[model samples]
Target: MSGIIGKKIGMTSIYGADGRNVACTVIEAGPCVVTQVKNEATDGYKAIQLSYDERKDKNTPKALKGHFAKAKTTPKKKVVEFRDFREEFEGQVKIGDKIMVGEVFKEAEFLDAIGTSKGKGFQGVVKRHGFAGVGEATHGQHNRLRAPGSIGACSFPSRVFKGIRMAGRTGGDRVKVINLQIMKIMPEKNLIVVSGSVPGAKNSYVILEK
Candidate 1:
């Protein structure tokens, strides 16, 4: 599952062949540098680490400076590793090699995008868990439209059951959206447009797997 680390360049809409406006998320994929090529004998596993986005050298730590020095590349803002890389690229690439979006995903028909979802802070059950908050306002219930009703289990349990969907923190999680159709690929711009909304905010880094 070899992939590239990219930035989410927001979303856009393009007209389809059927004369309908199709929504898509534009991602600036690759132009990434291979920082590390791991092997089973040396690291106990196989993986390819890619570095993307430029960062100031002064902000980078001493240990990271040495790591990037081995790759002979400048400081990067983001680095992601793909485990059990695709067979096509196995033994073909090495550290310091530049991998473009078009090279690895040229024939890819679909993609899996991994990113951090937008944080929604604290939310109620209705918005967070799709709970149908107390029905009609009848039965002498006043101003309880968005209430979570009763959570107790009478005398048997007395205490509210755990794992019950309730009001709490929401979003800001690692989300993997699978089977996103590849709508377009702008190789020159190093961008890949995938159908549907991608996780994370604009300019956030994402991992594109095919």
Candidate 2:
């Protein structure tokens, strides 16, 4: 389904009608400009390329400046393509058309969100790979607290297995968390509050899909 490009604006809790606080992820959803409109007859698919977050023209490259010039719009910090739109989108828009959050997902709830997860750099076996670690706390054990115990048999295999879980980089990958209830949509401020936390750090780019 078609979606809007957005940024995760931290998290906060709000009270509901039931007098209960609902944890939510506040996002700055698009007031995106339709940079390019693609169709089956031309691009072999029906899709819209939306540009969000304005940037200074001087900061943008000359080639990209001309690209934005074609749309008759200012340079943008990010651009993304969305496909599988509703039938109402058929020939309804063109390049340089501004698509605000109000235009598309008005009064929407239960949306699917996608973003890159927070990066946990250089994690160890106990944290990253979830190893048992050392197995004991005492019994004259010196300092084998967080080690991967017994990787292989004595001499049968002689070499460690290929697919063994070990310490490495963690997180910073694309993640999609779905079925989150949209508690509020502040079109005036181009903000959306959804019930529950989403992947990624604050100010990171996120995609909200139907």
Candidate 3:
């Protein structure tokens, strides 16, 4: 799918034409630079690499500095590739081209927003996996309220099985919200207002695909 790199610029509510308040997420989408163009003949696949956001030259590594120099652009904070870009833009896009949000997306179009969810650090099974705790507060159930009952079969298998839902890490995973409606497009500000919520915290980067 073809898409653009964007940043979540928080969220807000807007009055719709039907006099209803709609919640939307504001995203600073694109003005992304085409950093590299991969072709089947050379890279064994077809994909277009895009770079978004700016990074100071001093903070960028030497190798990456050289890579950005090839595209005649400054160091970027985020770089991602999209395979099988839209057919209309296939032969038109080349290295150093800038793709803006307004050029790619339109209001009312359905899109998929991909981003990393907010991290909740280490968590227990009750909060992490939504496990219903040990029934009632009776039968002398002390700290067994949030415990994960039995882990495995005892005498038969003799060992704990793999893929058991347990408490560990929570959130901070790649999440994709599908069928999000593009409510509005602000071309001058390079912002796209999307209906409903998106993954990740405010100001985090997200990819919008169609």
Candidate 4:
């Protein structure tokens, strides 16, 4: 799949031609720089590595400094590789080439957005796994409201199941939202407005793919 790295620039509602307001997420889909090009002969695979956003030289590691120097670009905050990019780019994209938002996506095109969901830290089963509470608060049920009722049977299994849903860390996982419609494209601002919401918080990086 061909994709571009972008930052979620919050969201807004725009009035459509039918006089209906539609909610959309604004993303700053780059001008991403081609940092590296891998080939089947050398790297054992074909892929194009793209770099987006900028980082200061002082904060960049020594090894990454040389890596970005090879591409003749500044240290990037995010780097991602996409296989089969040559088919979409017609085999013209090389190292140091810049890919803009308008070049990859068009208005009204359906695409997929991949991003890390917002972390909610340690959470209970009620919020994490959507486990319903243990009935009403009657019958002297003091603290059993949000508790996960009986994980395992008595001596039948003798132990809790491995895949049992429990309270634990939530979110902060890679999530893919598919078939998002690109409602508008602002080439000058390097922004693409996609219908509906995307994962992650505002300003977080996301991959928009087609």
Candidate 5:
């Protein structure tokens, strides 16, 4: 499906046509430049590589700088690839094609959002692994609260079972939520406000796919 790379510019509420306040995630979508185009014959697939957010030439890498040079555009901060584009969209989108959010997605009722989730660091089984911590709170349970309790049988396995639930790091992973409705599309400022909360913290890079 065709899509574009964008940034989560924060969130706000706007009134829908039904006169109800709808929570929306404001995103600074495209104005994304086509950095490369892949085909089955050449790259073994069909996709469009896009770049967003301009940066100083001195800060960009030599390979990326050359890639941008081929596209005839300045250096960009982020680059992403979209796969399986249609024939109509193929010729229209070439290297150096600047696809704004409005042009690519207009009146789009739904979208699929891909982003990195916020990190929560290391956590316990009660919070991280959802293990039912010691339930008793009044049976003389002084310090055993929020514990994983007995892990396994005494002598059957003689060792703690592998793949046992335990405390560990949480979040900071790639998450993709589908069917997010597009509330509004602003071409002038290259903004797309989507309904509901998207993954990741504010200002994080998000991919909005159709």
Candidate 6:
């Protein structure tokens, strides 16, 4: 897959060809810099690494600063690698070459948006795992409404089994939303709008793969 790194820019609604108002996630996608081009002979795999978003030199790690320097580009806030990259460009892309949103979306009709989902801290079973709580509170069911009902059987292998869906942490995960339709592209603004929602909060980095 070949892709570009982008920043989520909230969402908006727009009319489609069918005269329907379609909800879309707006993303500021690229002018991503090609920071590294890995080959099997070197890194044991073939990949294209792209860097996006500006970052202060002082805030960037020393090693990453050197890495960006090797690419002849400024320090970037996010870096992502795409393996088995599609031949989307006219020719080989070298370090420091910019992959603009318009150029990347020219050959893509749909994209897989990969991003970190908004973190919902520790939550209960009802909210985290969608468990149906004990209803009505009738028949002395107080304080057990949202509680995880049981652990395990009394005497047979009597420990709580793994992955029973008991609640702990929620969200703040790497999520990929596949096959989002290309709703609109404002190349002049280097922005892309895709149908439906994308993972992560506003200003978060998202990788759009084709």
Measured by lDDT, the strongest candidate is 3
**Candidate 5's TM-score:** 0.92
Most accurate candidate by TM-score: 4
lDDT of 6: 0.90
lDDT, residue 106, candidate 2: 56
Tens-place lDDT per residue, model 5, 1-210, is 889999999989999888999999999998899999999999999999999988999998999889899999999998998898655697677798888887678664799999999999999888887777798778788877789888898878888989988888999999999999888888899999899999999989999898
lDDT of each: 0.91, 0.88, 0.94, 0.93, 0.89, 0.90
Model 4 misplaced stretches (Cα beyond 4 Å): 17-19, 86-88
- Model 3 CA lDDT for position 44: 93
Q: What is the lDDT of residue 83 in candidate 3?
A: 96
Q: Candidate 4's residue-wise lDDT over 52-112, tens digit each?
A: 9999999999999999999999999999998877376856888899999999888888999
Q: Candidate 1's C-alpha lDDT?
A: 0.91
The collision pairs in model 3 are none
For residues 1-210, write the lDDT of model 3, one tens digit per residue: 799999999999887778899999999998999999998999998899999999999999999999999999999999999998888888899899999998789898999999999999999999999999877788888788898888988789999889999989899999999999898999999999998999999999999999
Residue 204 error for model 3, in Å?
0.9
Model 4, position 32: C-alpha lDDT score = 98
- Pick the winner on lDDT between candidates 2 and 4: 4
Error of 3 at 84 (Å): 1.1
* Winner by TM-score between candidate 3 and candidate 2: 3
